[model samples]
Target: MARRKTREEIKTQDKWNIEKMYPDNASAEKDLKESVSDAEKYGKYKGHLADSAESLADALIESDRIEQKLERAFVYSRMKLDEDNRAAEQQALYSKAAAAISQVSSLTSFVMPELIRIPEETLKQFIEDEPRLQTYRHLLDSAMRQKDHVLSEKEENILAQLGEVLSAPDQVFTMLNDADMKFGKIKDEEGKETELTHGNYISFMRSQNRQVRKDAYTHCYEAYKGMINTISANYSANVKTDVISARLRNYPSARAAALSSGRIPESVYDNLIDSVHSALPKMYEYVKLRKKLLGLDELKMYDIYVPLVKLPKKKIRFQQAVEIGKEGLAPLGDAYLQQFQKGIDSRWIDIYETEGKTSGAYSFGSYDSDPYVLMNFDSTLEDVFTLVHEMGHSMNSWLTRKTQPYVYGGHSIFTAEVASTVNETLLMKHLLKTESDPEMKKYILNMYLDAFKGTLFRQTMFAEFEKKTHEYAENGGGLTADWMNKTYDELNTEYFGPALSHDDYIQYEWARIPHFYNSFYVYQYATGYSAANAIADRILNGGEKERDDYLKFLSLGSSDYPVELLKVAGVDMSQREPVDRAMKVFSGLVDEFAELMEE
Candidate 1:
């Protein structure tokens, strides 16, 4: 087996040029420490937020300056650590950054509660009275919306001081999963053995070789199974923390707190679950069709990812994939494509998996830095899709950072997912329209169907599990390894239906999902995919106005409520129609795929 390369062994071009953000660790540490004094500047406005319009505007602007510096420091340190989790020096740098930010949080904890305490009439007049305060109308509005959940200043300060302690469960899980857990090795399709890592697990599952798929699945879950007890306890602690924090702030439930923070309606979450439940029959039909197409008597979990309609194998290498992505995503217009190309040329991507690298992909950077993407590219067509997906996120950041102020410069997961998935949608549409070969077209169709299955059906199931488990903890029930496994397994069976033959490996799945620690975040993938489908259709079928609207939406950042911001793109997420429409699309695609396979 080939040994995984160390960080230094990876090619220079394949890594992100993060040095542009900070020269070295010493510089990052220096900035982090200096930001401590900047945080203290907030003390000057503590008692005088409601004193006058000018004072209020000045305080908010000063806060933005301090936050920008702190964010840059935090982002630099974390990105450095993400490159190699085992590096002690990087770990220390990250710890210092986290501590610095937490201290800043402690120093400025009075800001939100104090803002909330101002009378609404007074606050409105302050905005009307000060022209400078116009920049913060939405910010103040958002704060007022959450006023019911704002605790006393002292309590807020206490929580800020305990920030790192409250984050212990997530930190413990990260260290254990990324640095400690090992899945050993598995035999590849040609009987050559290869090391099994998180980056290649999905590739193994999609291997035409069934035994390779089964082996990868078994080894991956078995490692989690070994640490299930610890994982369950750690996850329980995370849930407890979330519940207690929400209760302390007077939220009805942890879910309510999560949704309300972004001004999203709880009905949107429920609508996703309810709509997907109605569509599960179609999912079962697809699974049954998959079993028939594979000529298998029973479809096991490992059998799900292998493409049902086989196309000729071709290696889509990194450069080729980026070119294809450029072509596929060209419909987003020249301005968007130009920035994407610049990102490509500027070394804004870290492209490949190496020893001790964080698994999965993300687009990350502070407002002052280029939006950078981290990927594990194995040159599959699916990896091309991933490249475009993360680039979508980076493009969103790039546009938002250039156009919006620091306060609205980031994304709520709600709108963030839409940006990423829109790229995926456009890329798929491009492939389907341009590819001429019958088999290749069939493969593209298969990929599209699987995406719907994964995002709509699969993520909704995950959303339900998150909801149920949180409710369990809220009701004083223990989330032991056995109970979580049982709950997750039942959900799998319910979602996958009778076509799926259960395995022990399938139930341990929840233990391995890092997203569970993120609370109600997974549901956005489903919601966003739904919204993207609509937006993509508009751009393709409608006029230049439709394209302009989406571009504007991407630039809006968090300037408005997430659902309202999505309206700028012509998709209303508050209604269930988007999910219903997405379900219809899935149903049509399933019909098309089954007919092609049967032919």
Candidate 2:
């Protein structure tokens, strides 16, 4: 077997291509100089946007041009640095670009507040006079919407200076988890011991041996327990940052600040929690049933991942995954199906797992390039699902970018997951319809059921935990390591009901989940899966109109708020219908799997 690439090798592999982002250090220095000069030029328009519609048009257009170019340059450089931070030279280049961007942001931050202060009539007149201003009407409206939240330019300066430090907790925690943390030893089924690390955790969880799974789970948490204090401190700092910023900006609460960025209503968060709380008994029932099927007297955290039926040991090759994914997605018609084929043919994916490569999967792109996917293939069924999942994200990006301008090219996280999950749903549906082997069909159905249980029920539990933790912190509860562990343990018991072993190390789970730092993010995984289930059902049911609307939703991007955009696709997350429908779908899957196991 080929050895995994060392971190050093991965860095060296990219050094030549990394220079393409900036040309060289000299080119980056030049761009910084030019960007600063453009900021000064754009800054001349503060408070004067109402002077004339045509002149306001000219100023706003120039501002966007400079902003877009400067942003692209910064993003490219930053992405390069992020790809491999072990190289000091790349890290230094990132710092240089960041400092310059910071300085430019300080010089230009007052323009929006100043523009909003202009009289509405005057702004209207400018837009009426300049036909080109139509392109920016929405942009101008968004800035004005924050009129009440604007602070003095001096206060803005102070906030701008504090940006890096305010963001330090999330940054530091990511580096600590991704680059530094090392859990010691785990024994496999063969009675041999190996070093355990973050990347290997998934492989171990997929191990068929029940004992191996338990050992990995408990040992991983044991290592995390040693560092829980530092992790808790980091979590507390991140939550406090949200609270402080929300108050400083005069938002109603930290939740408001977080949700408003995605243009989500606070009630959406509240409704998700409320509905999930109401449905907890159903979730608890599912858990107990899972434990019963596993034939365990009492389950533990490690038992959650093992399939209710052990899947046949079938290894799926990387190329086979591509073909199956293409065939599975063919129901969307040839044009859409061909994109998957093109993605594979064009090498838009970086396939194969290597050392130091990022774990998990994601699709990313620059405005100038086609979206690219990164994956770690291990020939397992889950790895195949991951391919379809990430392709869902890539295809969404491809469709949106091809259809929309740069300003509207990206959707919020609220809608982003809908695309990915829709693809996964369609893929699973395709396999279920065609497969002939009973055991294989059962295996596929079980995987699909697991997806719903994990994404919908499990993540809602996470969302509730997030909400209560934030509320606790907001109401003066200190987020000590014990508090974090205790709260998590309570939630584990509540969500899992009496299915789990009480003595298990479920309390340490919070220390391992990276999403806690993101505050209110995990819930979207649940909500997104719900919405995707509804929309994908519509598309698969021969609803031409519904399919068209969903395609339009993909292209809508940030042109509207997420709720309104979703409404166009005929799913309103504001109501609990989507969640209820999704849960029923999940129950049906559980029933199917239960019947299969009985056979």
Candidate 3:
């Protein structure tokens, strides 16, 4: 193995040109000061929002400006900090930016309640009275729609002040998982001492060496098991916070409060869970096939990630991955393709991992800035897929920023994953159609199957766990470690079926999942994957109309509701058809993989 490069050693072309957001720290600080001043001045209109249509429109526009500025400063500082978290100065900059944002949010906190206080007819008249306010119609309407849920001004202010306190659970969970928990070390298949970490745990689980996989799994979970009590307390606090916050806001349930943010109907969440339940037999068939393919009498959870067929060794370079992604996403048309290429050429990506760099990949930027991606690129097929995935988000942001106003320029998390997963689906289709080598074909097919298993099935399992835990807390039950563990274990058994054996430590897996801190967020992964598959299929086979509609969806941002936007792209997520279609895709992939293995 080669030594990893430092941030300075990586080529300039491969790193994101975040200097576009700010030329230097000095410039960033300058903007931060300006933003604070602007926000302070903007606060003058807080109590005067309902004074007139012009007053309301002016406040909204100024608020938008301040937010856009804050986002640029914040993204730059945060990305700088992420590049090397150990740098104290970068950390300070990030902290300052965060504080500035919180200040602005605090200043503007009264805007919504004040607007909501206006009569519904008066607010509509305001929109009609001021043509300029027409640009904010959706924004104003969204606030008005929350009328039933909006509390009094004093209560809203109190909630705003408690924001930091409310976030304690997530903050504590992050510290424990990322900064404090230690997984120790284990010997790898190569007989080298390897450090066990959250980052590489999944890779170890996928090892062909069963003993190595089992050791890594046991050791990793053992660490979590040790911290189980503390983690459970923290998570329980998080659940209680969710329940209390929902009740305060008059939402019937925490899940309803969560889903309502993106205007998603509770039916969509229930439909996903129900549809997944109906598809368990297909998942069971896949598991049984895994057991037979591995020639094992019993399949363990650790055995789930190993590839069914050994793929030919093919190392894909960063540039090669970019070319492959471009080909895969070409169906979206030339303009979209050009935008993607521009992002690549303009140093919109930060490639290669360095010491202290953040783990994993993400696409982020402000409305005024170019959509940027951060990646720790290693030359593997997985890395290639991730490249396309982040690119999907980047392109979506790019299109939305270009087309929508600042207020609606960003998308919700509900629709965010759809863009990224669609890219992965298309990439898989491209590889399978073009690759002739049997082993390589099997490899890509297996990757597709694993994606479904992980994203669709595994996340749905997580979704179920989140729902149950929240329900338990809502019913006046305590979320003790044992209760969470037993509930998780039962769900694991139910989802994976009798074909797989669960290890004892596997029951504590919930303690290790960071997503649990974000209330009811994982369900989007399942629904978004399903929606992506349906949209990708249409774009690939349904011709120009489909491609145009999908592109239109990407440009929509928050202009319309997520489900409605998806419908425009030919995927109605409210119904069960999309989930069923995705399961059929999963079933077909399993059949193909089993047949290919026999050959």
Q: After superposition, how far is residue 246 of candidate 3 from its true place, in Å?
A: 0.9
Write down the lDDT of every candidate, Cα atoms only: 0.92, 0.75, 0.87
The positional error of residue 314 in candidate 1, measured at the CA in angstroms, is 2.0
Per-prediction CA RMSD (Å): 1.0, 2.8, 1.9
Instruction: Give per-residue CA lDDT, model 3, range 1-599, as digits (tens).
Output: 22346789888998899988888987887788889899889879978988999998888888888888888888899888778766789878877886777677666678778888999999899999999999988777788779899887778777876676787797577656755677888887788887776556666787889998999988988898998999999999999999999999999999999988778998888888888888899889889999998999879988999887776556799989989898998888899888888899999999887766767788999899989999887677788899999999999999999899998999998999999999999989989999988888887888898899889889999999999999999999999999999999999999999899877988998887888888888999899999999999999989999999999999999998788889889998888899988988888888878887888
Best by TM-score: 1
Q: Write the per-residue lDDT of candidate 1 for residues 228-304, one digit (tens) a residue.
A: 99999999999999899999999999999999878888899999999999999999999999998899987899999
Models ranked on lDDT: 1, 3, 2
Which parts of model 1 are misplaced by more than 4 Å? none
Model 3: per-residue Cα lDDT at residue 457: 86
TM-score of 1: 0.99
Model 2 root-mean-square deviation: 2.8
Model 2, 1-599: lDDT tens per residue? 22456545543332224343456656766776788788877767776766777767877778766766666566556555455545566567667667767777777777766677788777777777688888777667777777877788778877776766776787677667756676778786677787666656777876778888878887788878878899989988988887778789998778887787666887777776677677667666667777887788877778777776666577898789888888777766677888777877766676654544455667776555656676667788788789888988888888888887766777788998988988888888889999998888987887887787678767877887777777787787888888878888898787767767786477888877777777888889888998988887888886668778888888777777788889988899888889878777876776777778778
Greater-lDDT candidate between 2 and 3: 3
Q: What are the TM-scores, per candidate, against the unseen true structure?
A: 0.99, 0.92, 0.95
Highest lDDT against the true fold, candidate: 1
The candidate with the higher lDDT, 1 or 3, is 1
Return model 1's CA RMSD, one decimal: 1.0
